[model samples]
Target: MNFIDLFAGASGMSEGFINAGFVPVSHIEMDKYACDSIRTRAVYHYLKENDKEDYYNDYLKGNISREELYEHAPKQILDSVLNIEINDKSIKSIFEKIDKRLGDKEIDLIIGGPPCQAYSILGRHQENIENDPRNKLYIQYGRFLKKYQPRAFVFENVPGLLSAQKGQHFKNLKTYFRKMGYEVYHDKLNSADYGVLQARKRIIIVGWRKDNDHGFPAIEKIKRKFTVNDCFQDLPKLKPGEALKVTPYSLNKNEYLEKYELRNGVDFVTQHIARPHNERDLNIYKTAIKKWNRERVRIKYPDLPSHLKTHKNESSFIDRFKVVDGKGVSHTVVAHIAKDGHHYIHPDIKQCRSISVREAARLQSFPDNFFFEGPRTAAFKQIGNAVPPLMASAIANKMREYLCQI
Candidate 1:
């Protein structure tokens, strides 16, 4: 089966569908860094397919530059990632690019959701959010469906989308997609139910052509027996303001890592680096860690000592300085993590810092070999915005089964 990814965003959904044996016709994304990341991932997949993963490993080892890695992969694979925004002015050009990559192969599915920030709960708190341009990006998504007429589509977004604009937006979206000749069904899915250590929840909207009798794909729920600590145990520890591009694993792979294939038999891991924190923030992190370790209670921002309190309004976002629960599934990782790490403090007090890029990616169920292409902040934004590949793979597998039957 083949698919086209829209608003691809680091190719997280693309990663899962590809892993489930679906071929990507094209990936449409606007962010340069994320497009680069997707291109790098494409290189990895191509190299792996041809038994040239040593080139990929060398890139991770910093022995090969990105340009050199791209040199080893086919130009067509790299060119398939279109770094263009989807809008009225650009949609026609975007369609031309996808049509070129697609050739005569029909798109089996169209996968992606518009940026969810506009429909997120926190975004709704903003003034005049109804006017936010992102709220209408779904119209762009519908355009793809109309143009390609794919057999099915998977639209993923935050649960708040169901209630955005007093449910009118969602109603309008369904009406638009239905008018495009798709039978749409949506449900709320949790990542933890799909083998992810993070308890992230998303609204999954699946649509198929009206002629197809098959309904929504039955994505099976997986019962995970491990905790977030299982995801962290094999990683090398880091302190404030430390980064290791290539480092040996500190411990042997445990069952969880091995079971999920998080550690892909790589001798070294990249981007296991921590952000530098000032003493004041470090103190707050220490306090938060101690509280969670001792009493399993998260420390609110207002609970901090007067000397450490920086923000004046303590009424809202009180639990701003939260710690990742090492013993259980983590809270939803959000793109706001790029702005600051206060909400994603590492559980181990020894680190006394926010979770590193690799750690955040691990929480999002990205494998160790999936190298993110950008600085730490940009990588965090991509990871936070992505759908966990584990959950996506499950959906992809079910979708594939449904598509095959038809």
Candidate 2:
């Protein structure tokens, strides 16, 4: 069956559905960089169109100064202006194209994780208010459901979505979707239970169309936890800065970066290049590593934090990136790992070195053959933010069982 992935960032959700044997018919994304990483069945062309138009207008129109354009331009005139110019299409036309593709054939599901950070409980706490403009994007998702009338839909977001302000917003969301003729279930699910080897808990909202008699599946208990040893026990090991000859299992560097030139011969950068740290910084990193080792020993022998009790090998305090066992399942991968290597350390050594791109991918449960095609940070972000393909596949199987009851 076919499915449309909306707000598809790097196709993490799409990867899950594909693993579950569903075909992705289209994807809607605005970020050019992220779009480059995952091939889209379809994309919202309007964003690129407007951006191109805006660039050309800004550069070619010598008649209008930038300051004058910014200050004196009428609101109506600005509204008419395309940010990226392409006259070939609009959003409505794109949706129509999708509808044409869906004609006669049945699509089993529609899935996405719209940028829901604005409404996230963490965002609310940090921002000190609930005025995130992104919060309203769910309305757009709702509008899509009303229009397409898919058999089922899944909305994924941070766990904070369920606990934010005692879930008033979540209540409203359920009521609205229920009003739209769907029986919806929203709960936080731990990725580790589904072989992610991470402690991440995301809020997943699964729903069936009102016309359908499908009942939601009960959450099943997984007898075993996916561990670092389960995932990477078989891949060939590579040391820091050691580039492997173009292998079937490697990923290419991102095409959007200007700093590193990708020659035709070399497909990927082996690891993140490092710079020399000052003496004091080096000392601090050493101390952090020592402290981390001590913590690990203590946890293994005695009282341990709940988060670390079951994940002793994955708990590298210096930077969690290190694979404690070089040939084992990886620890929980987080988005912030891209910004700093503080959470990841080399699995083989105790130095404060960051994990290689390949190592990071393994940690996120990406198959060795699955490549990321953006800048380093973008690649890491994609890995960090994605739903582990294995975990997603398990969830999809459950969804199928849930739909069978209809």
Any runs in candidate 2 off by more than 4 Å, and if so which? Answer: 40-93, 119-122, 229-285, 297-332, 404-406
lDDT of each: 0.92, 0.56
lDDT (C-alpha) at residue 348 in model 2: 36
Q: If candidate 1 were superposed on the true structure by all CA atoms, what would the RMSD be? A: 0.9
Lowest summed lDDT window (length 10), candidate 2: 256-265
**How do the residues 276-308 of candidate 1 rate in per-residue lDDT, one tens digit apiece?**
999999999999999998999989877889999
RMSD to the true structure for each prediction, in A, is: 0.9, 12.0
How good is model 2 by TM-score?
0.69
User: Candidate 2 vs. truth: CA RMSD?
Assistant: 12.0
Judging by TM-score against the true structure, name the best candidate.
1
lDDT of each residue in 1-406, candidate 2, tens digit only = 6677777776767777766667666666665555655531111112133443342233222344433433433332222211221112455655666676567776677888767566553466566556665655666677667777788998888877766567787787888888777889777777766655556677888889877755555657554433453443333455434444233323333221111111122223233333234444344445444544555421121233343333445433424323243333345576766676645655433444556566666555555445465667777777777776656776787777666666
